[model samples]
Target: MDMVISNLQQQRAVTEQLRREAAIKRMLVSQAVADIVKFINEHEQDDCLLHGFTSQRINPFREKSSCTLI
Candidate 1:
């Protein structure tokens, strides 16, 4: 009976340890996701600023008109 109780206690301790590790991992993942979101927002703003330098017009292929003043 004593051996059985000892085994049960050890199993309980191991289970508690695993639970704590899992909680810590979950917390770290949550923090990482938040950081990624912040970084993506900043990157998107940077791209918006860069878009101003890009082309803003598309020329038509056929365009020839002239006015003569005689």
Candidate 2:
């Protein structure tokens, strides 16, 4: 009877440890996803700036003339 009780207690401890580890892993994954989304947003804004797509109150759909007459 004592041996059976001891075995049950050990199993419960192991189960609790596994549950804690799973919770930590879930938190880490959530943090990593947030970081990745922030990085992508920043990268997109930088790309737009690099390509002259600014929001400084300028025309964004204007056409340029490339012909000259002498």
Candidate 3:
């Protein structure tokens, strides 16, 4: 009877350790996902700025040719 009680206590300790490890792993994964989303949002804003600048630079050339015909 004493041996059985000791075995049960050991099993409970192991199960608690596994649960704590799983919780830590879940938190780490959630943080990584948040960081990735933040990076993508920043990159998209940078891309929009670059596109706008390029379009503005090309517009003057287009306007000059069109105005000569007017």
Candidate 4:
């Protein structure tokens, strides 16, 4: 039927749009992660600690080894 065909076309369009948007978002997140890693690596030092996706200059514990207690 014509109506069924049209509905399928609309659904396909929506699916394609969602895929494009997801790809764009994925690229943006990848770029952000790369930037964060570059920054951390550049500024990394004896006292620097990377916690998850972020970096901190000061150790969170009294002993440096305690930071790796995770």
CA RMSD, predictions in order: 16.0, 14.4, 14.9, 10.0
TM-score of 3: 0.36
Q: In model 3, which runs have C-alpha deviations exceeding 4 angstroms?
A: 26-70
lDDT of each: 0.74, 0.79, 0.76, 0.71
Best model number under lDDT:
2
User: In model 1, what lDDT does residue 67 have?
Assistant: 93
Residue pairs in clash, model 2 = none
TM-score of each: 0.36, 0.36, 0.36, 0.36
lDDT of 4 by residue, 1-70 (tens): 9999999999999999999988873458789999999987877763234433233434354445435454
Worst 10 residues of 4 by lDDT: 46-55
RMSD versus native structure for model 4: 10.0
- For 1-70, candidate 2 gives per-residue lDDT tens digits of 9999999999999999999988873458789999999998889756655677555446455575589889
10 residues in a row with least lDDT, candidate 3: 61-70
**Residue 23 in candidate 1, Cα distance off native in Å:** 0.2
Tens digits of per-residue lDDT for model 3 on 1-70? 9999999999999999999988873458789999999998889866644456456554543545344453
The 10-residue segment of model 2 with minimum total lDDT is 53-62
Error of 4 at 29 (Å): 9.9
